[model samples]
Target: MIKNAIYLLFSFFIIGCVSTKSTLKNVDYKATKPKIEKGKYVITEYANDPKYGYNKEYPINIGFANLHSEEYFVKLFFNGLTNPEGDIFSYEKIETCCPFPSNHNKMGVGLLHKYRVTFNNGTTKDLYINLYEKGEILCPNGFKILAN
Candidate 1:
């Protein structure tokens, strides 16, 4: 009796997790800012202005190479992001989506997308490298937020 009830509860739990599907659409970003050479984009002097606070001046590029299709990648590059003071901070999540290349195969090359953010203390961070197809990124990696 108890065992049967536990099994039923476990099955419902698994079903709840499986019901959620990814709701992401492909994007064709317009060049609102100047393009960088060598396939990189630069965000210069972002801290100097308030509008670009979340995204500081940095360089980024998107292209195909040394990666596999259907595989999304998320990498974070930073200097002194962690501090002893532990001043907890939060930033809005950024989303980027790339379409699957036509030449994609089980073993195909990958595309790269760079999002660079520079700090006021001369620290720089790069997020979302080769994040093609679709990927999820949470900044200050491994930090989970509690829901209100």
Candidate 2:
């Protein structure tokens, strides 16, 4: 009986201290649109709640001129975006403004930046990038939005 009680206690302790990383495989995906600002692609279709501390990264806009490229999913069923030929810009790469973070961070929103993109075709273009603010998505490229 003592051994059984100890096992139960150990199980409870282990369970309490465990942290989990989530995978999106079981998540339901919905097709959504994106915005193109100064030759940069912005996925504004994502719905993030700031109340839950989900607004960690501020929007950083990276840009290049006359950018033309093909974008595809990094994996067959993954959450990353990549380009094999053209230029690729993602919302994940944004936000490098402020250092201090709190429940509210000024880093959550900031100014835009420009970048020069050299594509696989050896062509050069100027690009501009910015965060996709709520109700700020002007163009939609059919990006994917996952829902529970």
Candidate 3:
């Protein structure tokens, strides 16, 4: 009887600690609807909220002109973490302000990128990135809001 009681207690404790990781797969970001900024860059949650003391690294894909080769092909992957408040965020991906070449689609477009990010509640957010250049780069904020 004592052994059974102990087992029951242990099982209950373990169940309480069990939790699920953050997976953006099948997550309806569209339903949530991202907040677009001035018809430019769009900001949205990474699925997992990494606020407070909890933090996780997310990966990003960067493509640009290879200055060395004088060609337009470059790829980089890196991990970045979220801020404490969850409002502020940063990634290892390179943020470029320069103009993309005319033939950027040949290299920069149609790339499937993946990143494993952790959230505030010990959950992980898997990010898939798809990059491209739109129109004639209107202004500094011409990047435009990327629709999911």
The best candidate by lDDT is 1
Error of 1 at 115 (Å): 3.0
Could you estimate the TM-score for every candidate?
Answer: 0.23, 0.23, 0.25
Please provide, for model 2 over 1-148, each residue's C-alpha lDDT reduced to its tens digit, 9 standing for 90 to 100.
9999998886566444433321111111232334433333444443343211122232221211111211221111112223343234333222322222111213222222333434445544333333222222221122232221
How many pairs collide in each candidate, listed in order?
Answer: 4, 16, 6
Answer with 2 or 3, whichever has the higher TM-score: 3
**Model 3: which residue pairs collide?**
22-124, 40-144, 40-145, 49-120, 50-119, 50-120
TM-score top scorer: 3
| lDDT per residue (tens digit) for residues 43-124 in model 1 | 2222232222132121122222235421221221121133223333222224432322322223222233444444335454
- Candidate 2 lDDT: 0.29
Better of 1 and 2 by lDDT: 1
lDDT measured at residue 34 in model 1 versus the true structure, 0 to 100 = 28
Tens digit of lDDT per residue, candidate 3, span 32-108? 22233433224332433322112112212222323442111111211122334333222222232222222344322
Candidate 2: where are CA atoms >4 Å away? 1-109, 135-148
Model 3's C-alpha root-mean-square deviation from the true structure amounts to 18.6
